[model samples]
Target: MDLGLRGKVALITGGSKGIGLATAISLSHEGAKLAICARNLEQLEEAAAKITDLTKGEVIFVQADVSSEEDCKRAVEQTFERFGRLDILVNNAGTSAAKPFEQVGTEAWRQDLELKLFGAIHCSSYAIPFMRQAGGGSIVNITTSSAKTPPASSLPTSVSRAAGLALTNAMSKDLAADQIRVNTVCIGLIRSDQIEKSWQRLAPELTWDEFAKDPRHDIPLGRIGNTEEAANVITFLSSEAASYVTGTSINIDGGKGAAL
Candidate 1:
């Protein structure tokens, strides 16, 4: 079914790889003009090329670290300047910080919160104007399932993601009058590039398949998720089909989270 997203403009943060890259490709498949940003120019170029190959759609890559307020502003501005208007903003730029509470230093806590929470805040602040200019739009913030059911050693990420969830709910109510819908997608163990790196460093003996199947948690599905799965949900949330979906934090974790 058509998502009615043709010609719409979307800006995705941390779009050079992993879930962000997957979302960019998914949006492009729906015929949306894309502006993807990341800190590394080389990776951005590679992702842009892959997106073009997949969707044959218009895609631009900008070098920007979402943790910096200035970079966030510039990224949004450049997107509007290139596309003329923004219809969707996917705040997916973040990392997984899962150190023990006692082990997490003050600097680590500050860095994680700065990158995950403030990144979305800064991007949404700048993108709202363009969305309003376009008459209305959607914002999908990529959080984690830990926000709802945080486990031991889930510090920094869980705390920051909880704040992100609150942000989503609050903005959904506040921005309703402007026709700007805000929502979040909570993730589980997905097969991202970052996960691949972790496997290489921590379990080099195991192959990708073996690594994903290693019973780390009692995931009901008995396996990890994929980038495309998460991206599909995000793309749906950003589309007209999800017009009524706001302030809700949906888990794409295959029933791994205990929260109802």
Candidate 2:
């Protein structure tokens, strides 16, 4: 199934590892030129090498923290400077800053919002003009399932992600005239770098396989999702295959989410 992404330029945030890295590889498989940004230069370099090795695709890595507006601008500018045009922007940079409702202080809330909400806002703002110049484009924002189905102890992330979903819908409407498509991929418990860290910290005695086994039973599919699974869906939304789709929040959670 050709996704019509050949020669298109894509910029993915938090592309150092996990879902972002997987998405970059997926898009590259569709023949898209890739630009990825992350806070850690070392990780970004490693990820770029891996993606290039797998797809033999052109990939550039930029070290930029998306929470900062200036960094967001720099990421977009760098991508455009190298690729000459930007067709897809994937807002996949964020962390799970979940805390109990009582523990979520004002500063915590502000920081999470800056990283998740404002990060997407800043990236899209910079990418829009270039996309318009290119005649059309796509923006895929990575959010969490908690945005739609609020669960206990899911703090700032839930609130910020819900805002992201709103932004996705609103931007889709506004950009539809420009031939730009906006969509969000709401995630569930996907096995990724972050989850690996949590598992190690929460249960140092258990091996990854053992730790994952417990939660696998909880998911309806009898297993957890992988980064590639989420990435496959994201690249679809970022390509012409989803030409008629916009303002939609699709869940990649293996039936873990309670809401529709």
Candidate 3:
């Protein structure tokens, strides 16, 4: 069951909370040194503390916005400087307003694309060098299932994530030649702060526990996914476990994609 990830290094975007935080903890527990980034220094520092408690792995937090080219470049550089190598890059940062297409403003759409899509692009551009230099590595992009199965009215974020899928597909071949594997992990309603806020806003009458059950009841398996579940898949994609898997999008959504 060992993923052979010991001594490896990773950089995760939006590592301050949710899936990103869980992935950081998971990989660290798997014995990987880590560097994670988020715009919120406080949250990033807190996440670093929790991961340090769990894995006792070398952890550093960089305060940066993934959408900015400068921040992405510095993040990769900081990882190399802190860990001396980069073995994995998890493009997990994203944001959206969950508004209808016509109702969504131009600025909101631009911001969503900038953070979710361009952020991945910027990170990949910088991280590729270290992966190339190290002779090989892995990149696991955290896109949403909405990209594949856009729920009734979530066009802006869906389109952005679709672009991410294309990017992940396109990078696989060229990167694989350098021993860098690239894959996309599509998410459903994994437990996170966003989901919590959504619950309060969308179903305020329901208790937290009751709200948690809503999505589970809706999905075939009758439950939403947890961060650990998603993180496990990410580590698999990053490690020797997924040696032959590349350019493939793995849905960690418990079969709620609606594509079948």
Candidate 4:
């Protein structure tokens, strides 16, 4: 289907790997110009190369840690400077920081909030003007299902993601007048770098497929989700295909999340 993404510019944070990289590639394939940012320059370069090689589309990489307000501003500025306009902003920069409530210290909570909550805020704030100038745009915030149905021992991550949900809802209402649509994807156990690290650390002896189907993850679909699966919904929300979708949260959890 024609998603009406051609010639549009998209900026994806944490785009160096995993779901963020997958989303960039998907958007590029739909003919969207991409500006992807991450803290690691090497990963950013590699991801840019991969996207360009696959889609032969315009892809720029920016090295910036989204947790910092200054870095978030710079990332948006560079995207606008490179593409002249920003059509989509995917706030995907974050890591899992789940643990027992008591185990999460003040610094840990602060860092998690900074990266997941403030990161989205800073980027969206900076990107709004550009989106307004372009007439309209989309902001797809990447969150987790834990925000809605946090399990035992889920601390900082759950709290931080809950704030993200609130942010998405509030931003959608505030930006709808400007034609800027805001939404979020509540992800589950998706295959990504972080998951890969967990596999290596927890059960390096088992094959990936074996580890993923270990039955402990409890995904109703009986397996973990792939990065592309998560990316597809994100691309749709960021495109004209979902032009009317806003202030909503979609769970890409393979039926793992208990709450709607």
Candidate 5:
């Protein structure tokens, strides 16, 4: 099961918690150096400590808001400066900003696009040349299953993620000549900090396990997914194990999504 990730360098946005943190740990376990960025320095420091404690691998934290183009560029530059190269770029910075179309104001829509869509664009744009210089690399964009099958009340998040899917496809084609592979993971309901907060707000009476197994979610797996489950796929895609995987999207939704 050698993923060929030893000594490789990866940059993960929004790596302060949840799937991003999980992915950073997973990659580090495989002997990959990591640069993770988030807006919150305290959370980023905590995440870095956790990863270092768990894997004892090289890991750095960058404080940056991916929504800002300059921040995205700085994150990549800092990664390259520290790591000497960039082998993987995981566009994992985003929030599930879902709401009814009528309820989502113009500013909310604009902000969603900036963070989810342009964030990926800006980071990848800066990381590409470095990847090309290194001979080849991988880019894994974190999207949502709703991008393919938009459910009711899923506004800007779905639209923004759909654009991410398109961006992944186009980038794969355009970067293929340079030996860079682009792929995306479409997430389902996964256990994370945000999900825990949601559980507390919506159903504090039920235990966490009870809330996760609620049949109302309709997850075919009979429960919500864990962060490591999603991270495994992302780590694979970011490694040589998925060298031929590109321009495609994988659903990690336990068959909850309607589309193929």
Candidate 6:
């Protein structure tokens, strides 16, 4: 029953909502001190409050745009300042700028990479040394199934996120010597505010519930996914339970990926 996370420290990016928020609470429940960051102050505050209420573990929030180096640095710096050590890093902050191939341009692609790929890069850059010094740690990147499936609508985001999987795998081998484990969760369609927004942007006519119905039938699980399911799996990997696992990408999509 013990995850051995009691009193340990974790830093989660994009922790204001959805999977990130859920992971924060789950980690807290296992007794990890948490530092979560997002660009929106209000959303971050609300999410932080909810996590604190749910887990009662030490939770702190800071405002940071993951796309910016200064902000990324500041987030990790603030986390270290507050926790005095970093045992886990969850890079869950990402955005997809979708468009038809011809319609997409350099800037859009750049932004997508900045948010999804480079954000992971920057956070990992700062998280590693402390983790090494503190006697190793875990890093979980919440990537998308888009990397595998490439949903027609989500363009550059898919490309960058796919790259993130590569990042996770590659880092796993490199960081293994330091005793730092790196793994990734390849996400499927999850019911969340971001999904709602994506739907509105791609197909404004249908309400979110209506939009969700079509996919539920196609996915073998007979339903989509939620924050809790994703968080639970990540919590397992984040714990000592997955001590031998690293550089592996687990597709938590209820058999949707279908790829070996």
Clash count, one per candidate: 0, 0, 2, 0, 0, 0
The residue-by-residue lDDT of candidate 4 on 139-232, one tens digit each, is 9999999999888899999999999999999999999999999999999999987899999999999999988888998988898889999999
Off by over 4 Å in 5: none
RMSD to the true structure for each prediction, in A, is 1.2, 1.5, 1.5, 1.0, 0.8, 2.3
TM for candidate 1 is: 0.96
Give the range of the ten consecutive residues with the poorest summed lDDT in model 6: 208-217
| Highest lDDT against the true fold, candidate | 5
Screening candidate 5 with a backbone cut-off below 3 angstroms (N, C-alpha, C), the clashing residue pairs are: none
| Cα lDDT listed for each candidate | 0.94, 0.94, 0.89, 0.95, 0.96, 0.88
Error of 4 at 243 (Å): 0.9
- Predicted structure 2: lDDT: 0.94
TM-score against native, each model: 0.96, 0.96, 0.95, 0.97, 0.98, 0.92
- Candidate 1 per-residue C-alpha lDDT over 1-260 given as tens digits, one digit per residue, 9 for 90 to 100: 88989999999999999999999999999999999999999999999999999899999988999889999999999999998999999999998889789999999998998899999999999999999999999999999999998899999899999999999999999999999999999999899877889899989999888888878857888878899999999999999999888999889888898885
- Number of backbone clashes in candidate 2: 0
lDDT of 5: 0.96
Best by TM-score: 5
lDDT of 5 by residue, 92-157 (tens): 999988889999999999999999999999999999999999999999999999999899999999
Ranking by TM-score: 5, 4, 1, 2, 3, 6
lDDT of 2 at 22: 93
How displaced is residue 257 in candidate 5, in Å? Answer: 0.5
Candidate 3: Cα lDDT at 94? 86
* Worst window of 10 by summed lDDT in candidate 5: 251-260
Look at candidate 6 and tell me the lDDT of residue 193: 82
lDDT of 6 at 110: 85
Candidate 3 residue-wise lDDT, 223-242, digit = tens: 77789999999989989888
Which scores higher on lDDT, 3 or 5? 5
When summed lDDT is taken over every stretch of 10 residues in candidate 4, the lowest stretch is 211-220
lDDT of 4: 0.95
